[model samples]
Target: MSDGNAKKTSSKESFLPQIFYNALLVGIMAGISWYAQKHSVTAGEFVGAFASIPLPVVLFAMVMDYLFDTGSLYRKVAGKKGLTGAITALGVAGFFFITMTWLVAGTITMNFSTITPVIYVVAGLLTLLLLWPKTGTTHFVLLYYIAVQLITKFAHFTLLGGVSLG
Candidate 1:
């Protein structure tokens, strides 16, 4: 029974090793975003590159933070391990937000540096809600993917949304 209980525990033991892997991937992606900010030539070019990444991660995380539950609410929170996982997930989500927001801002206009921060400021504000205990998602792999999409959707509107890849 103890083994079964341990298995049922979410976001802790299973996720710890994964944190390093995901963090490394996120770090690489962040570097790519920085590269895009500094090196990309035109808004259209940037748009194409930005749109190339799979996304809408933000919307998923929002749902997880607010609406997602495995009927696991009855179980006690997973203590420090769970907190670590959530915080790591939060950081992972943050990188996704920054990278995609920067990319999407580039899609809107080449003068993205000035506006990117402002856009994600709102994103950051919205992300704060994840602090609530409601965000007990078991899967960080998808959250990792969803973060980029969230920021993309937030800033897209018509400007970046319809960016012609031609």
Candidate 2:
């Protein structure tokens, strides 16, 4: 390949790792915040909660989230091409469906009775409608992931006063 082509490929490869790193960082921060909120009995106990979470659990959650987001994006963009693609798409969709169900159920148990699992399912379907033409670009996936996280956290705070473990 020409030097110009090589440079382009290298740049593209470099961009993916950066995104992965950023996702990992975000996941860790979210995990720590979740731990603090769940374990604290008072404001003073919040800081101590960080040290108590097992490192493996934090890493696992972050890694799982990162992989799920990546896989979902891949399925959205390329999973219509062949049999493998179809299987991958199905797997990714199934995983997200289960995850959203659990999230909705958990949030509901935290006293957010008005927010049902159907709402989350509908929101996800709407997002898919918006993303269909866009082909699941990395930028779009990242933004969507962050938005979901923020919304989930906000709901937790609003409904439970950020104190109760759901």
Candidate 3:
């Protein structure tokens, strides 16, 4: 007779490919975040677009996890493949942040220049660092969207000359 352990092992193996698929989809959605800034004309549009993307991203990540037959925590902290996937996901999230932030800043009577793209990159990184650990996929996506909008608005007002403080 066969041991029970064999059946369990087979089950686990079967499930992991699903997990990998989920993670990849998450990465794809996160990557899309970068594009929002270009399309946004107002803060409402920015928030709307940013709010909408993460569920699909997370759903993809979940599917990838199932496909890979891996656990979330395990893959999140494991070897090279895991790390690479996370980084790609983060990159997608970054794009979303930049797009939404630009939208909000435009609403506040601020002037945005081509250089704003550089600022968006930098701010996106900082927000990700702060929010990623404390928040899961959904919260991280939503909060970053909001944070980018407000912070960039304040920064534009304080540091830039477009508003003409004088």
What TM-score should be assigned to candidate 2?
Answer: 0.31
Better of 2 and 3 by TM-score: 2
TM-scores for every candidate against the unseen true structure: 0.31, 0.31, 0.26
lDDT of each: 0.44, 0.41, 0.42
Give one digit per residue, the lDDT tens place, for model 2 in 3-24.
9999998777556544544343
lDDT of 3: 0.42
lDDT of 2 at 46: 26
Put down candidate 1 lDDT per residue, 39-135, tens digits, no spaces.
5445444433333333443444445454423444212222224456556555645764555454444344455455543344333433433433344
Clashes in predicted model 1 = 6
Q: RMSD in angstroms, all models?
A: 11.9, 13.8, 13.1
lDDT accuracy of residue 35 in candidate 2 = 44
Pairs in steric clash, model 2 = none
Per-residue lDDT for 1-166 in model 3, tens only? 3779888876776455445545654554464365445644355543443333333332333343343233454344322244465565555455545543443233322445533343443334333432232233334434554465465553322222222221
- TM-score for predicted model 1 compared with the true structure: 0.31
| C-alpha lDDT of residue 61 in model 3 | 32
Model 1 per-residue lDDT at 123: 38
